[model samples]
Target: MMASRATARATGSFAAYTVSELTSLIRASLESAFGTIWVEGEISNFRLAPSGHTYLTLKDEVSGIRAVVFRGVGKRLGFCLENGLRVVCRGRLTVYEPRGDYQIIIDALEPKGIGARQLALEQLKARLADEGLFDTARKRALPSFPQQIGVVTSIAGAVVWDIIKVVHRRFPLADILIFPVTVQGQLAGRDIARMIRELNTQRTSDVLIVARGGGSAEDLRAFNEEQVARAIYQSRVPVISAVGHEIDYTVADLVADYRASTPSAAAEAATPALTELVNRLQSNHTRLAHSFSRLLQQWWAKVEALNVAGLDPQAVLQRYLQRVDELETRIGVCVMRNIDRVKEHVLGLCQGLGYCGPTKHTVRLVERVSHLTLRQDKQIVSFLETKSRAVESAGARLHALSPLAVLERGYAIARHWPSLKLLRAATDARVHDRVQLQLFNGCLLCKVQEVQQ
Candidate 1:
């Protein structure tokens, strides 16, 4: 049998070690063997310590392993670690020297199946949604045919290359302005955002293509960044986000004007095909030419019909000569007839002149004026008499309702002297408050002594 190091520790003569020394060796061997590995289990007894260390046990039906994620790694985890949540943890395996036990020191964590990147994506999506970044109202429509397309993506990748190829092939007239940017890692988000802003400020593109090729969730993190999403939202030009595969989505994709499943799709969406445009132009030209030809033919037909009506200028001219002789005879007859009719009309008008004379009209007008004056005078008198009676009746009723009438019956009215407020009950006058007793003759101001209700 081989003598193990742990067993040799028992025999001091054979270079034995203390308990602490043995634990250190075991910890080093375990860490070295499993530098970084993934372990899957459901979390149990999850606890966050006051010292900012998370202590938890990862367990399956058969066995369990202890794990601790320090404050640094825990902060990076987008989701909260809770009891019974199934997860896959990545870290170095080693023994805890103080407890003389082996466990994993978690460097990173991911939820099983769906992965850890989703947690960050979900958190960002929720945050952006609350700010109304995903509202359909904020999205703009892309230009049907963009004069210039601004491409924001990494030039080194196939993404920009595909966009250029597609745009050039489909619509050569559209100018492609490439705003190269990093598409991944920590700095990628800032670069992407900066380029988007630059394109907007300069108005470089009629429409923008924020593109990238397919990538893992982690590799696509830059597109999910709030900065990139906000930049897309704030862009004046319409933006089409072509990020990752068809199955993937990001904050940028949601915030952009349109989402393309691939870079080629984005190019196709941004502009119309040149061939289709040419075909439409050709059709329009044909319709216009046909219309012009039809109009010309109609005018030509009218001219030919006029020419077909055979008539000599001499024959038409003789008709005019005959008509002139007829007009000369008509002028002689019409003049004499018109002069007779004029004389008859003038004689009749002379007879009617006296009927419309001023003297006759004035006498008739004076008679009408006298009759109207009599009618007006009678109406005014009748109206005045009725108004006078109404006034008298109203004055009599007003006298009866007057408060002074009650004083005339020997019933006095008591009012607060200073305020002139009528007092109906003794409770209204406080002791020593000055009161005014209004009688038919005069008013007497007095102070309240003993009140009786």
Candidate 2:
């Protein structure tokens, strides 16, 4: 048996593999065996690198495995990755060469308990709410009278027609201007936001109505996007959001100035009923007319009573004249009293002026000026002394910091000749090379005999 084993070895039948080759073989085996698989586990040791790659460990109760999601796949993920999150992943198994360990290269991932889109929506809603975008204080009141109503919706959809019809029925005099946009699919959110901004820039509409027909959550995603919500929040023109049915609400609805149940409701809210306003105005006009007529009739009745009672016109005129004479006498007495009081006030002011004559004032000002001059002279001298001391201190400090002071302490600096480059080490100059030495008084030219290091 020993002879036969030796013969087999001598025939070159033995096989061996390097570390890289073995790892490649193991990777092939793992990929072939597992193919594409779905794994459910809790994430642990989650890390996000600056390069946008995600690294985490997927662990169950019994075991754990390393996983990596490259930038391309990670960018498409709807929700943030975090430790302790329960998730389900789809990928294939492979062997990592440097670590010689098995791992999963993730292609897809989602939270196990909720749908990815829903989770993303909830997270975004919370973030925007924290930024006060959903505050009721930021909401605006719809214009009571919007002459030009701006409608943002899909032109092909029935929503635009519903808004136009409602506006026409309630307030026919108001003009309708439609800003067409896609209400579904990928470009819907961006298109809606862009139209809102453009309408604001134009300033042609008093109020804006952003509406779409009722649809599923997925179909209504355009209204839930952050871009649409921010646009509604920042709109100068008050926005009435009517995205879906009464039971449905979106981010746009929260951020809009007013949330309407439907497209028709939004249009109705934006405009006032012309007939009602006209009726109110007519009622007010009739009431005012009645009040004026009543006033005129009351005056006429007083005159008629006077005539019925046979009041003498000559006697009434004499009585009025006597009253006027008495009023004139009282007004004359009051005028004399006012004139006496004003004369007394003038006398008091004259006495006050005599007490504070200009000569005394000028003397007081001269004394103040002399005092200020003396104080200013003393302050100038003190200031000069302080500045002189500071300058001397600064000069001393500068002299200590000067390189010539170090040279006076017997330290010399060497440099390569001609180039004047500083030589910090012996290796800087080779044997027989020219060098210059800087000293306290002068520089010395020399030749490098040897280099120690």
Best by TM-score: 2
Which pairs of residues have clashing backbones in candidate 2?
Answer: none
All candidates: TM-score: 0.46, 0.65
**C-alpha positional error of residue 72 in candidate 2 after TM-score superposition, expressed in Å:** 1.5
RMSD of 2: 7.8
Clashes of each: 0, 0
Query: Which lDDT value does model 2 have at 244?
Result: 91
Stretches of model 1 off by over 4 angstroms after superposition: 1-74, 80-114, 295-453
lDDT of 1 by residue, 412-434 (tens): 99999899999988899999999
Q: Where does candidate 2 stray beyond 4 Å? A: 1-32, 61-63, 82-85, 95-102, 245-247, 286-453
